[model samples]
Target: MSQGQHWREQLHEAAAQGDTASLLKVIRSAVAERADVGDYTLMSRLLKRIGRDEASRAGLRPVRVYIARSVTVESWLPYLAVEAAAAGFWLETKVGGYGSFAQELMSPEGALRDFNPDLVVFVTDVEDVAGGLPDACATGKPELVRAEVERGVKTMEDMLTAFRHHHRARLLVQGLCVPDPPVLGDAGDANWEASESRATQRINEQIAALCRRLGDAAFFDENRLASRFGKARWRDERMFRYCRLSIAAEFFAPYARALTHSIKVLFLPPHKVLCTDLDNTLWGGIVGEDKPSGILTGTDFPGNCYRTYQRYLKQLAARGILLAVVSKNNEKDVREAFRVRAQDLALTLDDFISLKISWQDKAVSLRELAQELSLGLDSFVLIDDDSVECEAVRQQVPGVLVIQAPREEPWRLTECVMASGAFDTLSVTAEDRARSDEYRAQAQRAQLENRAASREEFLASLQIVCRFISALEAPLSRTVQLINKTNQFNLTTRRYGTSEVESFAADPGGLALALRARDRFGDAGVIGIALCRTQDGTCTIDTLLLSCRVIGRGIESALLWYIARWAASLGANRLAGEYIPTAKNQPCADFYPRHGFRPAREAGGKQSRICYVLDLATQMPEKPAWIQTEEDLNNEPGPSCARVNEEFAR
Candidate 1:
């Protein structure tokens, strides 16, 4: 058999055996030979097929892939193209010549027209930018350079916009990986080296701006990759004077894999809730005996760290992550700490979803918290300064992520929690920042509910006001905060960046609403957010989550009514939502159904996949008298007693 046929047969055999390494070797050989024959189109198709097969086998189910194409070094294109395709993404390949200005080069609109990939990768060497710049700079005027920069920025923005508008695809711009200075000494004018560095930096900046504008863009710093691997591995003197194809392949391959995975994750809802431990975990001293006033918290060294940690926890609460305190402290002391000393403390009792302050084992308290919140122990992140407690939770809850509280320093505690990257979301919204306060307010409402004889009396005596902000103009900060922090009450739990939220608002069918609640005690600020998208005469609740503090106050029901009524006014026929149960959001497990939604299907128990459809033709429920109808809450200043206490009330 001929060399090409022999390699193809070997590749087929290797693929049959599920031997990735051997299959890749065959693919590489085919790519090398095809490049020699200059049949790039064939190479592209073959690579795409391999990628699709691999991704399917891996169960990745990738929707799109971005391929950066260069004409000058045509040999490398097929290899990179196949690599991306093998990873399971539909390829979005940019076609342009080597040493061509990235700004001046236009991708064949046809190549992207049909594929409509979800990601666009920019692959090119330093020479590509350098090659296109000199002609524009020959006149050497400041105005010309400025104009060129503007054009470059505009070009990148246009390219990114095309993908975003056409396919809602994310863009991944790779930095050029140039060989170390030594390899370039033997090639071309030495002065080109400095120019290449400057040009590459400019191009990278422009690409970063595009990503900023596009919101979902990612820039892979390949310069760091080249630096990690010595330059000699990629530098070539003959084929392309200043190319680093080998290094690009090595780094880009793994990067492509990561990017593809990220896209998949970005669309899926987040795991809800984060449970924590107290008593030396959230604060410095044990609260059981230490006078609440003596507890370590506030704006001082180690105390400051604990305070900072509490602030971080408060931020989490605002984002909708249910905060619960499971401690073996006396209830009286703990309650006092929150009431008297907690003003100076890092977190207050109101911020927690549930507080179990009995002298019970931590495991028992954790179970109680989970039960009260209607969550499973598996979703809890048991953090304690005591390694013994961490180990205990690990043994009791196998899936729970146990983190050791920073024993040596208090400030490092927040870093430890953030580093888990478990709660790393795209952005924080305004509603998120108000979450702790809302939850606190909810707790007070619950207290009122317990005091009154009837539900009507409790709600009326409590003087509750559920203000619906029809036009959420100024509280953009709170809106973004909720998008970032609220987890448990979040229906879709789709975390969005600030720019992405802005873009959503710009779109015709996207709507964002913020809700604020208040009663006799305090203003809850912007506590709830409902993000929806309109499609085919239906309004889909992309996210519907509220602070756990506000869980029992009927806020969720009110918010649902608001959405349904708004959809009716918009002439939408159906209102839809999903109830994706998570470790912490069990409190809302029956939320949709309780609000008159029916289950469309069930994906076994692995996913309680429910699709609710509400006919907008029905008469909308009357707004509750107890629920405030004021559209703006920011007009009312926060209560005076708000900053009176800082520490827990022990």
Candidate 2:
């Protein structure tokens, strides 16, 4: 037998026994040799078994997932489960009985509710969504297409409503794939008015709109997957007819992979920092050797590729990914290239949150960057063309993910980054877009700190303004963003979706107060969120978190004092708070004690939930003299907030 055949036999044996370590070793060896690791299905199946086994063991929590599909999916579920594992999840998955999606979702006392999955996947295809569309030969009317689209959308909305009523699982709806065999020959692609293709497109659009309206539901675009693999290859007529498979068996691995990538960013805590190289990675040539203007950047073959890549990175920065430069170039030259030479450069020197341009080892630089950013090393991705540097970071840093930058074609570099799914965001907020500006402002603040004679002088000169706006009046997007993203100073470290945030705002007994700060330097955007629930004469601080960028400036103290004052106005005798311990939130472990809050009875067995309370009958918590407070005049407080104020006034 050939050596390749021997390797395949060993892999198959390892998979059968659920030996994941051996399977991983085999895969890595094949990758090192640049050999084809054949049969991804088998590989993924082994991984699924391993993940399930790990989930069963203590201390390894798995994401409880349920897949509800209109078509048969038994054969491909293992692959999907395995993909979920690679994206940093162990899956405790339940596949609904064949063609039982409606029964599983709509039934009041269904098995789905009993399973209690964290994420629910609704999978369907064009046949299920737009099956009523007229034949290609028949002259279709736009009205007919519109009706079909509405029907498809209503069907999805029904499922979502059912799930929401019964449980709070995050919904992930897979959109209909682009149909094969164009209904209007090749003309349907261009003709959007009265074609079967147009009808399919309409259904997908309506589905997306429905997900947005539902707030928590996310539409995973399967049409893009079809385009990536080609419809002919991705779909199998035989499987559809006999087994009712929505996608071909051969294409299942990739489909699961793409879906898993979207799932990771949606449900999991996302990566924050992107550490990239300078020479040959961000631009065409070495800045030192090629000279400032000599570096290929704009309006050319390789140069345009680099330019486009930089533009993509800049966009990522705008969406709250902290960009850091880690290269072996002269710092002066690199800064000059960005500031003076690269006039058309998409990325400016200020775009990066951290700059480590020196002849030092990248692994050292990455550690320093993470330390400066106050983020875990695991929250970084190192992009470099040099394999040695990539390997070095991988070995030394160990936690940071390394992606090799494309050398031959610079434009493809962006594609490589996109494929990693490290930067995918479920919802974009104003704070996300203004992240670069906030970091620049932070730099200026740092300079002021260094120049100030003392901390009190620094705080006083800043002319800080802390405006408290009700959640309903404030931008819900940014509030939700802070709840999900802020780590260090977060009291509870609770992550909420847009729907959950809105629900808190609308709660009669609850109030969501968002704190927006600005100083002499600039506006810090929405930096803190305090969610409180009041009942009787007791008010409980459900969540109080501040962005780490604004931490150390007495923002947390200001937020606590504001919450106490607001609670007092609501006729509350006492304010309660809790500190949930997490690895990254050690900085906030003593937060409650540092404030005026006193220790209360510990809830949850083993004191897992540490409770603290402040007597509001006494004088209110004191705010810093440097901090000025005001109401947001432009936007009126929500009815809930006004009601609280009125009740307290009485």
Candidate 3:
């Protein structure tokens, strides 16, 4: 039998077996094999009997999503579940009452409040909230447009805020969809004043702005998604008439992907670097064979595709995704191409954080690159035109995400990577914008470290400074980002959302401190966060995490020193720290013990959780001598370390 027939036979057998193990295993294999979405829609029918919590133990992270919509979404739930599962999430979904999203969202005793979802999705359209918007557009008044935006946005904000008071779920709000053929016809496009499209776009802008102001909320542009799918086929009148469905059944999978893609970026940890191949991947020809000036990369037929890709890579670098060159070309040829052919290229020599151009195996080069950048292999995404190299890396360095750029359609490489969604992030901040430059600075630091004779001498010559600020004064977005993503040096390995971070920062009986580090090289923005709660006479550490970028720089030491002093100043005589073991956190197993924290035998420890305690009135940890803390330069002596010990905070 053919391979396709054999696969179909296995899928049918697995479904007929009627067991959770077989069903889940087949679904995962199908997703990896790029099976049709309709297969998943049918396979997920058996998921009704599989326990959501059981999925967690079966190697999937279980997440509950509350989808609130005015239209009928029952027919689309299976598609949504299967798409979200592709991102390592097993979905448990709750659907809000039809045409009652506002009441369900705002009511404290509503089903939404009881469901306690990890994400709350607002799938709405202009026709649902502002049905009069079309009539308002028919009248050529800008004030009516403004009034509709204001009314719709305020109502959304109110319901979202009310729901926020009860749950910490991150928000994913869909924007207003401007229906395909203008409701007012060609005359509507005569000018901006009469354009229904312009009015709908204005409302979408307000919705997006509201999400940003809400903090931890993300916007999904339904109109942009509909526009990509032929606007005329976006919805089916038959489905709408029978069940009030918002989109066509045939395109339900794509529609579901639109929503889950937003969810993946919001809750899933992002890849830090994009390691790309050079020969035929970045340009139309190999650098060595093309001889510097012969590569096709200007404004021509196939050349334009390469040039546009180069421009897109620059944009990704601007958003803080580090770029690197990973190619099996001579270093001399690569440098000569960029150095001499500068005018012909959109990319320059300084764009990449690291360049691996040699005869070494790509997997070996990737490992070396990870070590040089102080990042984990899992935090990388590789794009290469050569399928053999892609498969080799996928086998040798299994953690890395490999996107094979087919040689036949080089122009579609960017589209394939976008579909992979390897670099999706919840939000891009100023720190993200400065990421590539900071890594470049790290290379400079590496050079200085090599020049110094001893480790102590190297640290002292760097002039590192640590700035401590109250978490309330810090940007909660970055703080929460660090909390969710940092793993190696994290003591508890606990993840939290913006709402919980805000509550901790505002609590009168708590302490939330964030640490920012800078040196002779550059500023590593907000690298560490420590959350504490003081009750009775003891200060307990709830979460302490430091970014891998500053892992070996004694930054965590400086942070711990400051926290110990601050807890003493608050009149607490004892401090407590917890260690939760995970696969990625072996580096932090001895963190508390290294900082003069002894095992708290009085507090019984479990097999998985260990507790440590430090005497605040007596055993103050010794601060790293090479680092200069903000408190050290202060004229006022707010608090002092009670004692010093031999332990290092490394």
RMSD of each: 12.2, 4.1, 3.9
Q: Alpha carbon lDDT of residue 323, candidate 2?
A: 90
Each candidate: what lDDT? 0.59, 0.76, 0.79
Answer with 1 or 3, whichever has the higher TM-score: 3
Model 3: per-residue Cα lDDT over 475-521, one tens digit each: 88888788888878888877888778777766755767788889988
Better candidate number, 2 or 3, judged by TM-score: 3
lDDT agreement of model 2 with the native = 0.76
Off by over 4 Å in 1: 1-152, 172-206, 218-380, 383-399, 404-419, 461-464, 467-549, 563-620, 631-650
The TM-score, computed over Cα atoms with residue i paired to residue i, of candidate 3 is 0.91
Candidate 1 scores a C-alpha RMSD against the true structure in Å of 12.2
Where does candidate 3 stray beyond 4 Å? Answer: 1-34, 46-54, 57-59, 139-146, 190-194, 601-607, 631-650
Highest TM-score: which candidate?
3
